[model samples]
Target: MALPVLVLAVRWVMMIMGSDPRAVGLSAEPIDYTINYLGLWAIRFLILSLAITPLRTWARWSWLAPLRRPLGLWAFACALLHLSVYFLLDQLGSFSLLWESVAKHPFILLGMAAFTLLLPLALTSTRGAIRRIGARRWQALHRLVYLAAIFTAIHFILRVKGFQPEPWIYAGVAAVLLLVRALPTAWVRRA
Candidate 1:
């Protein structure tokens, strides 16, 4: 809470100073750079939240399980900021232009798709919703996160306009995460 608030304040100061956050080794946009990083934090923590299930089940860390929902909500909150920045600042309130960019820019499209998927998952993260849907159905709904990850990678990759190490790192992490669930089912013997 305090961290994000402080970061936002600093971002405003930097933007007012007319400094490029990325040029200063901060972020791409000095004004909204902090929000961008917050978005990244959201995505990273979302991934981390998903891993908690596997960690608890496989590694037997029951304590980590409790953190999932809160982290997921935090991720969602940050995602909202990310999208807000994209629309309000990046797109400059041009829905038409935003749609145009989605059609023309593969990265924008992929990222938009990823965020779209995340929207539903976040909405259903409540305890009442979980109880109403039950575990199996809820689990199925949340599985969209994996697809969201792929889209996110494509988003990052295309945004770079060429090969970049950072996107590859994200891709690799998402791959390992998906594989964890996949390898088990693949190894199951039909008796």
Candidate 2:
């Protein structure tokens, strides 16, 4: 919602400022920072979307169910932005460089895999799509989100250099979220 808009606004402002001394402390390359920021937000929203079902079931918060679609869409949007930043700003429209980076970096492949999985889920998110595809089939297809989330967490972990806690924390959160989803319905109900 407003969060994505604000982030985009700030990015726009930074671009206009053009090598302002104040931004030096943020990162050597502002585009790189923005790409990472977008990717992180994508992961956060994806995790939040997965949490909706567990929260609704355990906490009896039925209203949270509807929020899942919007959250998931937002995650996809952020991921799209992340990819755009890397392809456009980082690679500068050079297909050779893009291919070189993808071939050299396994994390880029993981991120691409995650984004590929998300694409179909985002496409079939609408009510009309659900009706056309049938609810059961749609649900089965959307289960790919869990796999996408795993790939995304791995991508984040692999992308970072050295020993960073942030990626590990994201991985831990994703694991817990997946565990909640994996639990039996009866077990969840008993809790």
Candidate 3:
């Protein structure tokens, strides 16, 4: 599960360090490439995490629920990497630039909001943390991933130059996954 995340992180590191400045499937600019690549992946993992429970029910695969933890953590890592690249490379480690971006760009604010929401979820995604927090409270807290995904979707769409179907497709997937959760259990189980 972590293998893909590890490889992607390494590749991003290499890109940032000039070892591989060309982004294969993303923007030509390294900073934009890193930021966009990581941002999209962050949202992907987040939506995948959100899909676990619903998939478990729909498929009658109880084992699927355990997959959410690692996916959520990966999503959190991607989000952290995305923000780190922007702050470190794009902002040149300047707080003033970060603040300026936040002020001037609503997309940046949305991205920050999504990251803020995922922080606690990732931090507490462990058996020990679950035990300490109590199962019920922990479940409630982790539900923030859904909101995080929404914010990420919005951030992704807004960060681009104009309306594009790709970001909209992501948003659509997030919405469908969320809708699945709101569905009646009996109805979902029948599907």
Q: Pick the candidate with the highest TM-score.
A: 2
Clashes of 3: 0
Judge candidate 3 at residue 142 and give its lDDT.
82
Structural similarity to truth (TM-score) of each candidate:
0.81, 0.91, 0.88
Clashing pairs in 3: none
Which segments of model 1 are wrong by more than 4 Å? Answer: 1-6, 13-28, 185-191
Off by over 4 Å in 3: 3-5, 9-20, 23-28
Q: lDDT by residue for model 1 over 1-191, one digit each (tens)?
A: 33663566676677669876665556664535654576677667667766776776566688987798877777677777778877887788899989998899887888789889989999998889999999899999998988887887666666565567986787787777777776563243221
For candidate 3, the TM-score is 0.88
Please say which candidate is ahead in lDDT: 1 or 2.
2
Candidate lDDT scores, in order, read 0.74, 0.87, 0.83
Estimate, for each residue in 75-188, the C-alpha lDDT of model 3 and write its tens digit: 898889889988998999999999998888888898998999998987898899999999999989988888888889999888777667998998999999998889999987
Model 3: lDDT equals: 0.83
Candidate order by TM-score, highest to lowest? 2, 3, 1
Q: Is candidate 2 or candidate 3 better by lDDT?
A: 2
